[model samples]
Target: MKVEDFDMFCTLLRQRSGLVLTSDKAYLLESRLMPVARKWTLKSLDELAVAVRSKRDEALLRDITEAMTTNESSFFRDQKPFDQFKQVVLPHLLANRAAKKQIRVWSAACSSGQEAYSLAMLLQEEGARLAGWRIEILGTDLSSEMVNKARAGLYTQFEVQRGLPITHLVKYFKQMGDKWQLNDDIRGKVQYREYNLLSDLTPLGQFDVIFCRNVLIYFDQPTKSKVLEAMAKLLPPDGILYLGGAETVLGITEKFKPMEGQRGLYTLAAK
Candidate 1:
């Protein structure tokens, strides 16, 4: 792509999604956007850029934005966060909210629903303990296609294999021809929606816990701080937030502090 075209494309992405694409990552534009270009009948990224620059093609622009957003996810990804949830977070929240007997979890930027489904499986395993409790798992992402997939609860053989134990797989999934479909019981526990982190989050309601993992890595520091602050507003004083291994609250916002001895876990800061 031409230098001017590349710069305009980067600007468009940043304006729409808060993603920062420096020159070093320009190759990503060429690689990830080729399919988008072809879909729109553009011969090359340069043509795509020209189309974006020359016209207000909302549909085309939306596709480009969604294409650029990272969607990498797996069941029980990164192990430790789920471990912390099962071992520490769940127990603590259970005891703390025993009177209410309700808990809500938001899996922010929940790409394709793996993390939310993982949580549902864990809760399903503890079904006896939560017999009378009200549980809601909200999984939201920027991609409607991913939201639909997550809602369908269908996965390819390779998708189910990643970080999914054979025992749970056999217990919870039934093979449908080739792809594996999660049981209705587990799939029913979670809700999926298309949401932008940069948009208003208050409409989603308050939550006891949230998993905003890995997504802020794509945003600039200012955007990171802004998004974090918005999330902090949705939490109660004792609510927990789980970020990716590489993300931290240290330099971002003062609304939260690391939960001692818990990896990727944070709680609202004390008054």
Candidate 2:
């Protein structure tokens, strides 16, 4: 790829989706975008970049962004986060929010709905305690393809095998030829939306807990702070934020502090 073409794509990805496409990973970008290039009838990535830069086709730009955005996810990924949610966060919310009996969870950058559905499964396990309460789980991702797949609530055998237990799979999913589709009860508990984290989040309303795992590692520091602080606005003092095990709010923002003894758990800092 030409130097200018590489620079243009890097800038485009950062501006459009806050993805920092470093030069070292240019080959990865080229590989991922080759199919998109073919889809648009372009001969090579250079042609695709020139067309995107010169023509500014919004649809093509969106396709490029989606192609580059990583959608890696698995059910109940990182067992600790889910365990903390069940043992710590849920109890806190259950005890504190009795009067209103309402809770809302957001799975930001929710790739294929596994994280949100895992939470739904946990909620189902607490069926008796939460019977009369209203709980809502919303999963959002920038990629429309992923949002649609998440809505379908279907997973291949390989996908189900990862981070998912035999008991839960048997209880919650029905085998369809080669894939497993989650039961309507669990699937219905969560809703999926195609959304960008770079935009204003106020319209999404408040969330009592947010699971924004594994996505921020792609962002630059400023972009990380931008996204984290923006999320801070949507959470109450008692609300908890769950980031990927490698991600943190330290030196990023004062909006949240690490929850004691919880590796990825964060709570709003005191005013």
Candidate 3:
């Protein structure tokens, strides 16, 4: 693809999905967009670029944006966060919300439901502790395809093997042909929806904890600040925010302060 065409494509992606792409990322774009190009019977990446440049076809632009967004994820990815959730966050939330008898969690950019499902399993293990509590675990992603997969609650053997404990897998999933179908009991705990971090989140409501890991790295600084600010508004003053190890609240916003004991955890500071 020509440099000008590539720049236009990158700009379009940044505007639509908040994904930042450099000239070095041309190969990445080609790898992801090639399939879309073929599906549309386009001869080459350059041709696809022209189609995107037309801007008259919003559907085509959406297709391109969706094609570029990464949807890779697995069950209970990076076990530490979930462990902390069970050991610290859940207990605190349970105690604090005892009177209300309800708890809310938002898994922003939840690719295929694993993070939300992991939380469900943790809550299930708590058993009677959450008996009367209204547990709302909401998982949202920019990609509609990913939200659909999360709703399906199906996983391949390889997918189940990654980051999931063998014991939980045996207990919560049943064999469906060669794949594992997450038990409806666990599956029902999470509600998946299509959401874009770049857009307004008023319809999704608030949360006690929000897990938005490893996603903001793809976004530019302005987009990251915007997203973090929006998330801060949705979170309670004491609500927890969990970010990827590479991500931090520092330099992004001052609304959140890193927790003293937790590494990747942050809490909205008191006024």
Candidate 4:
């Protein structure tokens, strides 16, 4: 792509998805959009840029943005977050919300549902304790395709092997021909939606625990702060937020503070 065209493409992506792209990331953008270009029967990335500029098609723009959005996720991506959930966060939430007997967890930017499903499995393990309780696990991604796949609850052998324990796998999944399909009970526990994190989050309602992990690295400082502030509003005083190990609320926003002894865990800051 030409230098001018590359800049335009980057600007479009930022405007649509809040994804920041530097000059060094030009190759990464090209790699992710090549398939989109081919799908639209464009000859080159430059041509794709031209088409986007001339047409300004909403669907096309959405497709390109979704393609560039990273969807890398695993059953438990990192071990510590789940550990914190089971050991600390969930326990605290269960006791506090005992009066209502309801708990809600949001897996923001939940790529293909693994993170959400993993939480469902944990809830399943605690089913006896939560027998009369209402549990809701919501998984949202910017990509509609990913949301659909997540709702389907189907996984390849390779996907199932990633971070999924052998015992849990045997208990929760059924081998459907060559792939594994999560059982209906676990699959029914979570809901998937295609939503942009940069947009209004109020409609999703407040969540007791939110896992918005590994998604802020792509945004600029201003965008990062904006997102963190919005997240703060959705969280109650005691609500927990989990970010990627590389991401932090410090130096970005005052809405959240690190959990005293927990790594990659945060809670709303005191006013």
What does candidate 3's lDDT look like per residue over 1-271, in tens digits?
7888888889889999999998889999889888888988898988888877674487778788889998878878888999899899988998899899989999999988888999999889998878888998999998888899999999999999998889999999999999999999999999999899899987788899999999989998889989988898998888999999999878988888899989999998777
lDDT of 4 at 15: 84
TM-score: model 4 vs. ground truth = 0.98
| Local accuracy of candidate 4 as per-residue lDDT tens digits, 27-111 | 8988999999999999889889889999999988988998998989889778889999999998899899999999999999999
Model 1: residues with Cα > 4 Å off, grouped in runs: none
Candidate 1 residue lDDT tens string, 97-212: 99999999999989889999999999988889888999999999988888999999999999999999899899999999999999999999999989988888899999999999
Q: Residue 14 deviation, candidate 1, in Å? A: 1.8
- lDDT per residue (tens digit) for residues 24-79 in model 2: 99898889999999999999998897899789999999999999999999988989
**Candidate 2 off by > 4 Å:** none
- Which pairs clash (backbone N, Cα, C closer than 3 Å) in model 4? none
TM-score, candidate 3, is: 0.97
- lDDT of candidate 4? 0.92
Worst 10 residues of 3 by lDDT: 51-60
Kindly report which residue stretches of model 3 are placed more than 4 angstroms away from their true locations once superposed.
Answer: none
Ranking by lDDT: 2, 4, 1, 3
List, in order, the clash count of every candidate structure: 0, 0, 0, 0
Where is the poorest 10-residue window by lDDT in model 1? 47-56
Task: Using lDDT as the measure, name the better of candidate 2 and candidate 4.
Answer: 2
* CA lDDT scores, all candidates in order: 0.92, 0.93, 0.89, 0.92
Clashes of 3: 0
